[model samples]
Target: MTDSTATRATKPFRFGVVAPLTTDLPTWRDRVRRIAGSGYSTLLMPDVPKWQPAPAPTLAAAAGLADLRVGTWVYASPLRPAWSTAWEAHSLSVLTDGRFEMGIGTGRPGIEDELRELGLPVTRPGERLAQVRETVTRLRELDGPDLHTPVVMAVRGPKARALAAEFADTVTFALMPGDDRAEMTRLVRDFRTDRDVELSQHVAVVGDSVAPFMASPDTDPAALRAADSLAVLPDDPAAAAEEIQRRREEIGFSYFVFGADFAEKLAPVVAELAGH
Candidate 1:
């Protein structure tokens, strides 16, 4: 399908895998090399605590592999001071030769307890937006020559989405609860038409072996197929390609990210669809 005029052809199509931050060094090192060799565009790390490893070092390790870009899927903003993240992200940018993109967010729900345990302040929407803006400012000021880090705003709310559109290098319309493929597609179109920023999407890639474990509660294979084009399926390469190309045409989505477990499963699809 031909892209809408609103979609800029200058934006490139790319693919990424969201790796767990908590993974051991050796496993992560091996997986990152595998991801790069498999033709994925980038190897990403999630900011969630469950991912046990730290994002900065993991991203650095993956950067060591030849020609692989690194980034965060999304980082919880209220968990750390804006200056801290800004400093660390620039450090990452330097370490990775400007291949780092900071994915900042308002933060996940159910994080208050963790914040209190760490004696950190739990910020509201207004404050979090302020932090996003300030953090971006600090990153630009601190970065070395020709080393400006790209910012990926993980839009979780209206204000957050607006912030991303106005300020971020790219805006990701995450697939949240109650979101189906159609809604995601519509949002992608709207964002593309309304903003000049690049677009990204977050979804799971499900192969036959991984589908069961990756399925959401009460979601079956038929349900997933019925829901939307969110999960990239092994059996439906044509459908996957169609959905991917459709989004690319409409929204100029150069970045597609999936969880690490399913990243390998998506290699062939990436091989077929990337950069087209």
Candidate 2:
């Protein structure tokens, strides 16, 4: 299990880096090494289209690096068959020695639209949540690998959050514009019955205000869309980091999913807060 809960319960803070899966594997591994070396505990890579280069190869390649834990910032639940996702996750779990985590959602309109263009179901959140739950169950049944990887549910509404608390090991959210921190906290504190599960938070970059500080396109399409649409900050990486920090405090999100473009530029910000 990921230490997100332990970090939340005992530690003062938790930190992670968002890998730009868009880059080459070697480069992504190098960056993951740096982030892990810098004391960040987790690395998140979101899912995108097959044609779109992403962080999966890099995450698999970096599996042997120290004790770093790897996670998918998110994977579009409605795009592909549930079993395919389960098996893919099982492969990563086996490869990463159970250090892999996955973020899942019914998928946003953009993803649904894209998948529909390809003749797939654009499942609504309710149907998708049920499918996701089944997938998680099936993933747990895999025998060849350790299959100990956890699933972090990404959802926004009350019903979805409740489902996540019951089925997922962790509950996550993309802190888009107008996200309600108070509401989120309330939802988590109330809906969760599993004492073992943890809650994770995510935020995106909006504009030049925090553009340079962002890593790049390592995050999944849903998150990328959220960041592109909501995260508006200064273009200078440093300024963007500062702005991102400000927003983090404002929304009460400890786990941030950033782009690879702002990695070096935002390093200072992460350093100032995490010191790892």
Candidate 3:
């Protein structure tokens, strides 16, 4: 199916910045305010433990300081009990006055090692998917009837996609570097065949710089450009805007996320295309 046939083409464009707080409190507050002032719709935090502050408290702080939405650029489901995760997500939704989105997934690649390191159970893929489902289910129960917290799911395999179809308000593909653009197109088309959930693309690199935790430190921009990876975007504002429009038109990707490092540089593109 072509983009014209896809349901997400009608969705307005929006951008999100995945910025982990790596600075002092005052500096971080300034960065959050700056991102809000820019045209980005959401301020997202990574879920990696020990790398930065916890997502909940930090996200709450960001929400207090900015007018934009806040979210976990995805919570790793295997780290905590489903109820605990759900309760935290629901609290964020309430604390942010419904401006919080719960972006979650089974976990990143090789998360089992991390779980083992943390002394958490290393669950199988199916079990991890079950954990994700339970978390969403309990979150809905906690949210009650009046509040429906938005769910953004990062999916890779068929099972995860099926689960996402059942519960997600937004879905982002868990794509790796050098993955084929055509394959991603097919996935988006297939997922949107009978569903109109929002489609999000996680951009790892803008120009020559790779965002922290988004990709390997040694990631080569030249190689990504040569391979035409979707994880990278052109640095020039016009070129980036053009590529973003093309992605939305052809692959049904209307929500683009970038690392916080390039949020300022990409603000112009956000200004030109956001909510359009």
Give the root-mean-square deviation of each candidate in angstroms. 3.7, 6.1, 1.9
Error of 3 at 186 (Å): 1.5
Computed on alpha carbons, the lDDT of every model, listed in order, comes to 0.71, 0.62, 0.90
Q: Model 2 RMSD to the real structure?
A: 6.1
**Comparing 1 and 3 by lDDT, which wins?**
3
Window of ten residues with lowest summed lDDT in model 3: 1-10
- Give me the candidate number with maximum lDDT: 3
* Model 2: per-residue Cα lDDT over 124-225, one tens digit each: 667887778777877878734534678888877767766776777776654444434454445444454534555455544534323322324443434434
Q: Which candidate comes out best when scored by TM-score?
A: 3
- Model 3 misplaced regions, further than 4 Å: 1-5
Model 1 lDDT tens row, 1-276:
222335455476688887764456687778878888888888777776643677888778778865888888777788778899999999998877788889887766566777787788877778877988888888888985667798998775666766776778878765655566677767655552344567787665454433222235454545555665555454565666667777676556767777777766567778887776
What candidate 2 gets wrong by more than 4 Å, as runs, is: 1-12, 24-26, 54-56, 64-67, 143-147, 180-190, 206-254, 268-276
Candidate 1, overall lDDT? 0.71
lDDT of 3 at 65: 95
Candidate 2 residue-wise lDDT at 106: 73
Candidate 3 accuracy as TM-score: 0.96
lDDT of 2: 0.62
Model 2 / residue 94 / CA error / Å? 1.4
Task: Score residue 239 of candidate 1 by CA lDDT.
Answer: 61
